[model samples]
Target chain A: MAAPESGDGNNGAARMVTLISSDNTRFEVEAAAASLSQTLQLTILDGGGGGGDGIPLPNVDSATLSKVLEYCIKHAPAAANGGAPNATAVDRAELERFDNEFVNIDQSVLYSLIMAAHNLEIEGLQSLVAKKVADMIKGKSPMEIRRTLGFPDPTPEEQAEMNAHMLEYGWAYE
Target chain B: MAELLRQEAVEKVAEIEAQDSEGVHQEDRLSELPDDILMCILDRLAVLRDVARTSVLSKRWRHVVGLLTEITLSAADFESPVNGSKPTFDVVVQSNMDMVKAVTSILAHTSRRTIELLSLRFYLRDESIDIFRSVDHTMQNREVVKASFAVFPEMRDMVCTDDDMVIYGRRFLSFFYNYPRVFGGLKFLYISCVRLGKFDIANIFSTSIELEYLCLNNCDCGIRSLLQIEHPQLMGLKIICCAFEKVELNWLPKLQLWTYDSWMNSEDRYPLSFGYVPQPCNLRLINTGTTLHKTIKLSDFLDNAIIRQLNLDFQSGSVGDLKTRK
Candidate 1:
């Protein structure tokens, strides 16, 4: 990749940053998109992720980092507009469509993205993934939720506790 | 002992982390997530019952229930009788009571965390008093930043007589009087199908000091009664299908949007007049039910007020008959 230009002072080109995953893979992206993460915003603001140096995220792996970056790139424009209060209906609808399709992935990938999002402190991505997981388990019984989330079969003690909880709060179950 | 259990959980999670590399049987990874991540997931499950059920997922998830900052309990969450079958009075009462019991049980786990939002939508009934008291108690202990309420009468608007609506309004006022702090802290409130008196309506506005948005659907005072609105923090107001003779927008400093739909009087060209509204930007006047034969003048209706965006929908296709000033 070419070295990012700096000190030119507003040459009308968007400044870029490099983010290194835990596996030491470098991915180049715009500073605005990477700044969507509260954790990365300060570093990007301080001119740390340009040129030869890159922000290394130790907790996020390569595959998950790519997925997280995709969300940040898509949401950066709207976020730059202070949530785009004056955005057209079509623009808002397109973002909604993109978000709904973005989180449609395998459970394992979804869990990885959730953790990466949590570690990176991306508020929008975190809420999107959490809403996806919540939709998966909404209106299900305790046992049903465990199975849906791929939890192992409850032990006898756990089963007894679940039963006791159900007995005490029968209204919730109903 | 609590520390020991946490240590055991961490060790168990570490073991699971090791197994994740094998590429076989990727179950139970969700439980291994940290408490904050788990709390984030549970926050979207606004229904407190669903959040409560997560406690049985494992020992670690039991405390996550208390950390939830947004809670919504609606009577519609409980199953009602079939549509064709007319539910008896007792069935309706029982359903309301069950919803209240669920709400009470959920509130029992308040960890004194600051709640960002607490919204409740329930049928107007005696059991609703229990919900009011529980929410008041929750407010007293914790700081609820934004609270919203949508109250509905047991009888539908079409079936209810004027007397029934008056009684429901009285019950709502009584609840408001009893829990003044809860109403005072509300940022958004929606009331439907209630016939409130002139003073009763004004009293609600006085107590709901922090209100930003207020929606009144299928509600009104007496026939063609002049109702005046004055609030300090209200930004949006919607009046839908109400039987008010005239509505006077009196002294709303922060009002930005007002939507008036289908007033009772068809003979009166304008059903609303403005007073001391400094910042209204959007005004929507919709009349989809009937046609106005007289030519409605927008200049006279708006008087000297300058609105940025005005939407007039006379679904009867009479936009041409309406007059506007240059």
Candidate 2:
């Protein structure tokens, strides 16, 4: 059995740091905990930022990373648990409840989760957050949509282009 | 809860619209990413319509449907033709042909870096249909077995028609073996409600090695082996509305879920005979007593395999598809 790459920094037990972005703030986290992101997972594995080193995630901030860590800590096994129990009905329901509660933040936090989950490669988090984002897109007018997404007022050309598509898809305009 | 969900939905809609107007450009954003990311995104999409419509997003999305290695569209989907009059059916058929043309063009464009999924549902013969031969001939000859094609055979489900039921020849069945080889790696094949002979289906089943799940809905090939299925990596098998006189259940070595919903209301109770049962299948759902009876015959052979769970929802409409509470 190979030793996990984190304890005592031996037998590839080397540690590293992950810099997350939340409110433009950064916090360094353990490499193993941070490895949960697929984007970062490969970079870390490729030795870009292993051995207790620093890897800056300029996109993620401290607040969102803190929330991501909470979710990952609950879900990430030591790789010893062999990838989160195969999702039995009860466990699935429990996880659902946890997810429902976890995403209960303002639109700002939800957006951060989406980008962070994408960057980190937390598949479950990505799905949950993507679904959360997709859910928000449902049943809203154009003005309401513009307001919720925090997009600045669209220029005339941008508005025309956007309207053309929204009308074409008939999801947003109608 | 519903109101909260609705309100949240309204708020989220507003957000996506705002984002679409600003941060995201009108051109391809995520679609331009590598095929792997595209596949991941497609995996989350529930139906084939979502895949078809992805192309409407931008040029990069133009060929995403073909890039999909495995595509499944419910025969019940709206794009599926509904029975109607000659002109109406012709118009619908033309429109359907157009959609298929568009999809196939997409398939041609993508060349399927990963895989290609093509599924079609045609309206059955009705009194309103034109009762012609050229269209029927074209429908009978062309096929969409593989993901990509050149001499692209027009695809049409063959069945008996009221006006011209004379030319119900078996020539169309020969094309089964010629299923487009381009999609040799296609992971799933689902053909429902079409009347295909059992032997032809067996030939088709025997040929595709990459198929992971095979479903035959309402299509009867007589009493024979529905799946001489040698899909070693196959995981799921669903057969509904298919009538098999005496179908053998052999060759599924690694199947997880095998569901046969042929709800027959007969006093015989045990209508089917099992020759060799595929064991190791963990979840078996039996609503019809006849199928259970057939399964029971293989008890000795299946003894080595222990099913972790057996779901027998046998009631009056025991074989009913539990799609809704009603």
Candidate 3:
């Protein structure tokens, strides 16, 4: 494990790192922003992913990497402040607005984002996407949740089992 | 640029739906996710029953629901069936029995995991002992950070019968006294409608070192005794509609908020007293009775403490009476 960063003293001299997605697309991001991912933070602290050498993320696609980077950059400053005790109400509200808008994507993209966030071990992005998926499945029945997640329709045997369980625990389905 | 991005996302979803309609390939991507991610989604559900229902989705979800760390069980989740209009006495009893069985099953399954929050609210009856024992046994080895156990006995003839109330109270007192270890990790506790004596209350405050919030509503304390609450980590205390001769706060170093809301008919002016609250506090007093002496007593108490905010609501007396008394 890498030692945690001490403070934001070297904010102006923050280094930049390159990330190579699985499809061979190169993107440059600040070291502070990319460090939001625990996996990337350890490698970057060990003097890795510097000039001419980019971290390869074979599990994440180009589209999902950009979305994940967008979240990391937006949240990097607050993360550096260590929760920002002196943050004004307006500042906190603005970050909350950004989070709410960030997760408002299509179901397929949201699924991909959940995977990328998990693979990178980014805490905030993982929680945001999980909460979005949970909200999508919140008050719906089992069939509704299955359909919303794009699972194929239940087979005859599976449907019979669901009917029996629904009959047993009727309150949950209601 | 945002519009173009939205259009692309919408088209991607449309493509997935188009592929989903064809019967060639079918994938349960949600179920195929890692256990930790699925557990994250399961933990966000507000009700435990909803989590239990996920088992019917597929075989993979059966074991995932058992990994949740929070459990909330309520009486409304197990209401009895009605016969034409009203449920018979036997039906009600059977419903309570079924609820106890359900709770026992859940506890037996989740006994190995560390529970962060466990809330159980049910009407007290003969079957309540089983429910309480199941909870105690399950939480014995687990670290439950927050726990609430409330028992509201059913009222007969528009009044809560004293015999039933005493039975429920004694049950609660014995449960806590027998298993003092359960209180060692609680951070928030909300208890209502249970009878507690001086020893029971003191035992809880002394054992629960992490207790930060305590709410006692419609409780019966021992008669003619001062209910002294002395806890080191207690931050907020609220007492509503509870009967006691007096309440003395002692040694609560971190006490920041204290609220007492009730109608007092006591002759003693000072029914509540502060002993060693050094921090700036937010105090709220809502007395509905027209006792001028009580108002004067509260004013005197306020004169001694460092009150950051005071919210006082009296029904019968005016502020002028309090001023004149002062």
| Candidate 3 lDDT tens digits, A1-174 | 232354346555567778887679998988888888876776777666778877777667788889999999898888877766767888899999999999988777777787777777798888988888778777778887777766679999999988886765554554
Error of 2 at A52 (Å): 9.4
* Deviation of model 2 at A77, angstroms: 7.1
Per-candidate clash tally: 1, 30, 0
Tens digit of lDDT per residue, candidate 1, span B1-326?
A: 43343233233323323224235444546666777788888978867788878777776777777677888777776756488675556666777778788767667775798889888888888669878888889888888898998887887767888888889888887788899888898998898888887887898899899999999987888777878999999999999888887889988999989999888655545688888888846888888755644446666778856687888888666544344432
Please provide TM-scores, in order, for all candidate models, with all chains considered together.
Answer: 0.69, 0.49, 0.70
Mind giving the per-residue lDDT tens digits that candidate 2 earns over A77-129? 43324554665677667767888999878766665566556555577787777
- Sorted by TM-score (best first), the order is 3, 1, 2
Per-chain TM-score of chain A in candidate 3 equals 0.89
* TM-score winner, 1 or 3: 3
Q: Candidate 3 at A134: error in angstroms?
A: 1.4
Model 2 lDDT, full chain set: 0.48
| lDDT (tens digit, per residue) of candidate 1 on A54-77 | 776666678888999999889887
Candidate 2: deviation at residue A7, Å? 9.7
Cα displacement (Å) at residue A137, model 2: 5.8
Best by TM-score: 3
